[model samples]
Target: MQAWDDIINIAMIGTDKKQPDTISVPASLAEITTRIITGSEKNREEQFLQLASLLYNYQRCGISPLKKETAGTAAPVEEKKYCSTHAALALRDVLQDDNHSLLQYWLERCDSRTQIAPARFVPALLINGERNKKLRLLISSCVGKRGEWLSGFNTAWDFSAKQTQEEIWQTGSLEERQEVLQQTLVTDPLKAREWIRQTWQQEDAATKLVLLSILAPFADESDIDFLEGLSKEKSKKLQLFALESLRTIPGSPIVLMYESFLRSAVTIQKETSMLGFSKKNTLQCKLPDAVSEDLYKTGIDKLSSDKTWTDDEYVVFQVMQYVPPSFWEKTFQLSAEALLELFEKTDTGKKLLPALTKAAANFRDRNWANVIAQRRSVFQKELLPLLPLAPRDSYINHFFAKNINDVMDYAKETDEPWSMEMTRLILREAAKKPYPYVGFFQKVIAQIPVAVSTELSSYPVSEDQYSRSLWSGMSEEISRTLAIKNQINNAFTI
Candidate 1:
């Protein structure tokens, strides 16, 4: 090792700067090194290269095999039957194409029938599951005993392995620990909190941030004290994250303070019509000339990033983002529709409506989402997920003709199977603009239900030559994917 280190130093200094005669080799390799350098009439650089090559080979060849423990016992007999050959072939195609949605559908169907993945595909499934957390549980269900057995050898797949949750929490990698934290949070949040509390001091800042995020969705009144303590952390990002988590808890001190501030800063006033028969509610925002110390401590920024809006407008925007949209409804004593109507008519609406839309999304307020979706100027595609199935489909149906690209964006967000009516609508529209949007269609092929395969078959051919070529190719791909999906479904049934 010392000889190799000397050779490395000589190499780093270069032959011109340090003579090749300075090179050293292990006792066993010394003879070969001398032979390589002695009779060679080569210059110092060539001699150095030769000696370096010899030492590198000697070091590599001398490496001792790592002393690992005994090979584990053979995998146990699988309780579940392997999937049918056709189903395995379908899985192979999905994997080969790297089509995640279809892969999920395949795993779901296989698990529904209580069949394990083919032995050959278990490793690939486990590897994919390692990268995609959403697929891990599904993969665990369908990969069955062999996959589970294989997981024991690769710690990366420990989520599917038979290790106890406590064991994984203590010894697993960061990802595995986070997964365990999430599962424990769902089953026993108190225990999860205790674990984080015990390890809080030992974790680095980044790890603490991740652990805090894992607690966000499951955060409750019990977590308020812990989160409030973290809100005072020196790390700005960690402190901000803790504050954000507290905002999600309804009665947390931060939320109560935010509510108290907003209660005075924003108010609704009633206005009478000229005839004095009808009344309208107007949103009146009165931000402080300066952001108070208390408000600033709650993480409200003092300046507006948007050049068009003043600092005060931006401050109000940040406040609205944290408070649930329902707060506006309760405070104003108006329906979501009426409150939206008020926000839209005011000069302040420009800044507040976006924040309101964001709050609707953040708080998962369906009523506010629906009302906001009705305003064409303010609606965002991000709101699609908040709408229930019937309303979402209706929204898409209403807007699909003018906003084909938007519908494509929504398809990318979700893996839910399309209804027959929506399927027909999308297919008909996609055929009309097959050049670009058809490519988007190819990605979402799994979302098209199998029942629509018949419609794909009966689809009319285009009259134009160019359009015909594109549709023909698109139609064949759709048909083939549907046929494979059908085969996968039938294989599981049998």
Candidate 2:
């Protein structure tokens, strides 16, 4: 191809300008030259493939010849000269420019590896640049030899652990080839879970735990059983990991299993408040009478007085998180007046009331309405004024918005971050939208906080530095558009 010849001639001409004996080819030209030197001559398609690869290499990776001289011995021996790599870099300057159009000519000339490559830098060629197609070809060519490629495109310049993992996962066969799979799981929870499900029975306990580590991304109700099954294994760490993982899944069936044990072992510790003492020394958390009260019979209250079962907050929070809000509704059914009396008696009772309100919403109970009506006068006069400035205000808002829609509307009017987050959650829950905080999204985007703004702005600077930079910038732009679409969908749902 003329382009290849031009590239080689330019490198030879620039040898003196670059450095003695160093023929520095420009970015795309070096690749073109390499293709001409190494390409097969049998078919048009094959030759074109070679040319395409050469162009990619030159534009993306640059040329390979650099002359390195040995240290002087002064004995007049022939100089140790390495090949010059400068030719590869010069081509980059041309490829990176917006108007330097070579892709059309390159595509037409190499359309098919031919006995003789086409001569026309074909003006009428119907080639349009495509990223995904080019990427697929690049991946097919570079799959196993990533380390070599990485040397040319250093990690600092093109770091993509996800891509590296994908290459191995798509090509490698060994399940025990743990690095790629482990990293995949660590970074992508859904992918890791699917990987585990695909290869679970075949893996050992240690491997299972490694796979389970991916579930750390977001815990849900379904993870409980997977964790519980591991608890039967002899490895205490695996069992513990399983047990710990269950706490994160909010609506998990695992709670029913642990509920009885907890009720029996734990007790309601006495608590006090700055508001002053009431008639009762200890507040009672009343429960609704149930046909199958067995669920409420966890021995946790029995051990409340004992200090022996101290564990991490995550452990306690696990049960607390999953324990259905409906349970509090049942407690209210026993005696609404008694519950009010208890709320007045202790600080813990005050904390427990909002939780009860949430439970009332979940269960859709009218008792909560009656209780609110009875306390309306005192609540408005005292509690309502202190709510915004109170230490537990955020928590109160969170619980109320979670359990009650009216309260969420109130928060929306206030337009605080907590309100925005709650609104987002509600939008996701009720409207099936991905992110409901449309206003919040708009606000943040318009005047992004300083902490995250600068990194966002300079993302495009790389491509001008390397022809490779252009491709990278294009890819990033596409990803940002997709992200914006997802946010828009979420806003609509909200």
Best by lDDT: 1
RMSD of each: 6.2, 21.1
Candidate 2 Cα deviation (angstroms), residue 297: 16
lDDT of 2 by residue, 1-494 (tens): 34445445545665334221113445535555555545456354454445545644555554566543532323222122211233212222212321112221222222222211111211111111122222222222222232223223332313212245555554443442354555555577577566666667777777667656645434465566666677677877777677666644554555565454335432444456667574334643332233233333422232233344333222332334345444433533536666556555665455445544443333334544345444531221122222333322444444553344444444444423333334334433322221233333322221122233223333333223443444344334433433433332232233
Which parts of model 2 have CA positions greater than 4 angstroms off? Answer: 1-192, 201-210, 248-253, 258-282, 285-322, 330-344, 347-448, 451-494
Top-scoring candidate (TM-score): 1
lDDT of each: 0.78, 0.39
lDDT of 1 by residue, 1-494 (tens): 77778778887887777665534455777677777678558877787788878778878998997653534567778888898888888888888867676788889888878888888999999999998876776788788787887776777886677567787788767877897898899898888889999989999999999998888877888988988898567799998888888877777777777787788888878899999999977777887455459878776888887898877678888888778888877887888877788888888876688888877776767887887776654556767877877677777777777877777777776757776767777788767767776666556767888888777757665678998888878888888777777877777776
The whole-model C-alpha lDDT of candidate 2 against the native structure comes to 0.39
Q: Which regions in candidate 1 have their CA more than 4 angstroms from the true location?
A: 1-74, 84-86, 92-101, 112-114, 118-161, 183-191, 272-279, 288-291, 302-312, 375-377, 396-415, 418-479
**Number of clashes in model 1?**
0
Error of 1 at 480 (Å): 3.8
